[model samples]
Target: MSVSGHLATITSAEENAFIFDSVANGNNAWFGLSDAETEGTFTWVTGELLDYTNWFTGEPNNDAILGEDFGEFKADGFWNDLPSAAKASYLVEYSTSVPTPPGIMLLMIALTCLILQRKRIIFKTE
Candidate 1:
């Protein structure tokens, strides 16, 4: 499915954390949140319920006169609503995969090797 189709499913804190960490690296980026159809009722582009939101303090104020209907992740990892025409990078979420850190992968490999070695030693003694 497209990112818009899956964006509403970002219901977990881990998913939110990953998105914030990935997109908020000293730069602002757009996401799927929007209220283009009806102000104050933010929804995903795919029409899914925007059940998970991390808006910054005093945000989603719809304070712009031209209509601020799109959501963006600021450089500080806070969320803010912006005009759709605003030029900024956007974030697209894929439901099929979760990004794993290199350090975690290395630790898993090391643990696996240690367990296999211990098994081999036990078998030899028996």
Candidate 2:
């Protein structure tokens, strides 16, 4: 199946630490950074501005021999560029627009009141 959602891009040290500690501690995963579009510049899948990066030293070396272009989160929490064919776990994020609980409750109350008023009108007419 095709996966959706933007890749996780580290914007700050805190974010990096959190992701490293929580997600990257023991697993290698595919993150959002990639130079597949351009040679040197990396961009997140979300299309957000490239405000932060945490590349390991000498990473994204774009080793022409290896043909590394996709970003990978190593077990050490540092990032490196690997070939797109590299096998690794991946993370997917989703954004949803949903009504708040309060809003749902208010809508329910309004519907109840409208139903009661309609019943009363029907009874009077009968």
Provide TM-scores for the models.
0.61, 0.72
Q: Which residue runs of candidate 1 sit more than 4 Å off their true CA positions?
A: 1-9, 95-126
TM-score of candidate 2 versus the correct structure, residues matched by position: 0.72
Sum up the clashes in candidate 2: 0
lDDT of 1 by residue, 1-126 (tens): 223233333455676687667655777888878788887888777766667778899998896686899888777777889987789887776555457889999999999999999999999999
Could you tell me the lDDT of residue 27 within candidate 2? 91
- Per-residue CA lDDT of model 2 for 3-118, tens digit only, reads 44567777777877888888776898998888888888888887878877778999879888888999888888888899988899976565666556888999999999999999
Q: What are the lDDT scores of the predictions, listed in order?
A: 0.76, 0.82
CA displacement after TM-score superposition, residue 92 of candidate 1 (Å): 1.2
Mark the 10 consecutive residues where model 1 has the least summed lDDT. Answer: 1-10
Clashing residue pairs in all predictions, respectively, total 0, 0
Clashing pairs in 2: none
